[model samples]
Target: MADLTMARLHEAMTVLYAISLVFYFIDYLNKDAKAHRIAFWLVSIVWVMQSVFLGLYITETHRFPILSLFEGIYFYAWLLVTISILLHCLYRVDLPVFFLNVIGFIFISIHTFAPNQIAQSPVGDSLISELLIIHITFAILSYVAFSLSFVFSTLYLILYNVLKKKKWTKQWTRLPSLDQAQKGMSSALLTGIPFLLISLILGLQWGFASFDHFSIFDAKIIGSFISLLIYCLILFGYRKGKLHTTMYAWTQVYAFLIIIINFFLGSRLSSFHFWN
Candidate 1:
């Protein structure tokens, strides 16, 4: 019975995300204020509902679902959606909603379609529940924030590059000025920094305590650190006034690519912080 309800909620969440994504695209393309507002509202409601569902899930299982990659992906998507909501509200920028919707749709869609690949029911053991939540809460939050920022970075890069080459002026110009896009990406980075720090700190603590300090030196950790450095460097550029919106945007896109490679870094490489 609980399984059925959880499955239904997941389905509902996916559909809601898809609907929100469609409306956001419409808002982006048509520049319709009504559609934009509707899209934003939908994202906000759906995100809050997702949090409620997660709470229900943990209550039912009495455990955190941070044991597997698919579960991690689900949690990551949740964090991204939440941060996307918070960041968009803070910035009040159109482009953030547009790209975040698109990226959220992709993340949700892949997981929805590959259900068998992602879901795993770990034993609800007592020993790990508290520690599990502690680990997963930070784990998903940080990586997911980085993941969303990567998407924003990608958009900034593409938009900036297109403008530089003068490729799609009339269409792209309607999207957002490069300056607005740049600001939006920077905003995402700025907001994401703290989450990443928390994640990294908790992860290190867990590693040192468990395995008798036998931490796995994996690719994800190295890649994530590299990603952290890349963004930091970009931020430094901003501080020095050398990272123009467009250039900063370009770095974000590259940063996203680097992050994607890091996904496999967790699975394949040996230095990943959370190589599960």
Candidate 2:
């Protein structure tokens, strides 16, 4: 029961942390004071929650939580969150604080979703189920990020066409500026790529651990990997001055279609994933 409660608390803290990152990203883009304030408070809450957990661990284990790999990851993530909050409060460095939390989020996700380390569970079999849960959760979050980027990209194209045609409708007045849309689309992609990469890694690890006849060339696995690579390529191209304006928007649209297909068709084609 205690473990279960801790698990739920860990999950809740991660969700809060992710939301705070979103706000921080907004503040990073536009320097919105309200957004910055909200982010700071949310991060503060997460830090407090982490501190409570650490306290509980110390009380129960009678030692600091840096003695094992699992405990070490939790401590590391906690330290990052602590430092990130301090940076936000002391220096008001938006970009550095945002990135610090992102790294912290990744490590926290790993620690939260990691398999039980109890002596009762065999070491090899421990990863079979919990890692799958982590893989699916991370993958879904990545899709959510991608979906948001798709909306921003779509808006960019709409605004671009409207401007090209010179149809200055009041309805179009509320749309974000072209630069804003572009930045938002890029930010979403940046947030998503690391998540998808982590999901792929955890998924592959789960596959190897869970299956007797696992193939690295499995259809779903390949499709997901390809999706990650394409997004990386798109981001790389944009950063290199190769894609922008209509071209950049169109690229994201096409890449999103690949994700859609990979999600539905790839699942059906995979021999084990369908059953799993």
- The candidate that achieves the highest TM-score relative to the unseen native structure: 1
Q: lDDT (0-100) at residue 51 of candidate 2? A: 95
Candidate 2 Cα errors over 4 Å, as ranges: 1-128
- lDDT string, candidate 1, 1-276, tens digits: 976876777788788777877877786677677987788888888788778877876787666667666666666677677767876788665665566666666776666667583454332332353554576566566556666566666666777678788788444644556566666567768766666666666666665665565553546656666767887887888889998765666677777677667765555555333333
Clash list (residue pairs), candidate 1: 153-252, 153-253, 217-270, 217-271, 218-270, 218-271, 218-272, 219-271, 219-272, 221-272
Error of 1 at 2 (Å): 4.8
Total clashing pairs for each candidate: 10, 0
The prediction achieving the highest lDDT against the true structure is 2
Model 2 is weakest, by summed lDDT over 10 consecutive residues, at 118-127
What lDDT would each prediction earn against the true structure? 0.66, 0.76
Tell me each candidate's TM-score.
0.75, 0.55
How many Å off is the CA of 234 in candidate 2?
A: 0.4
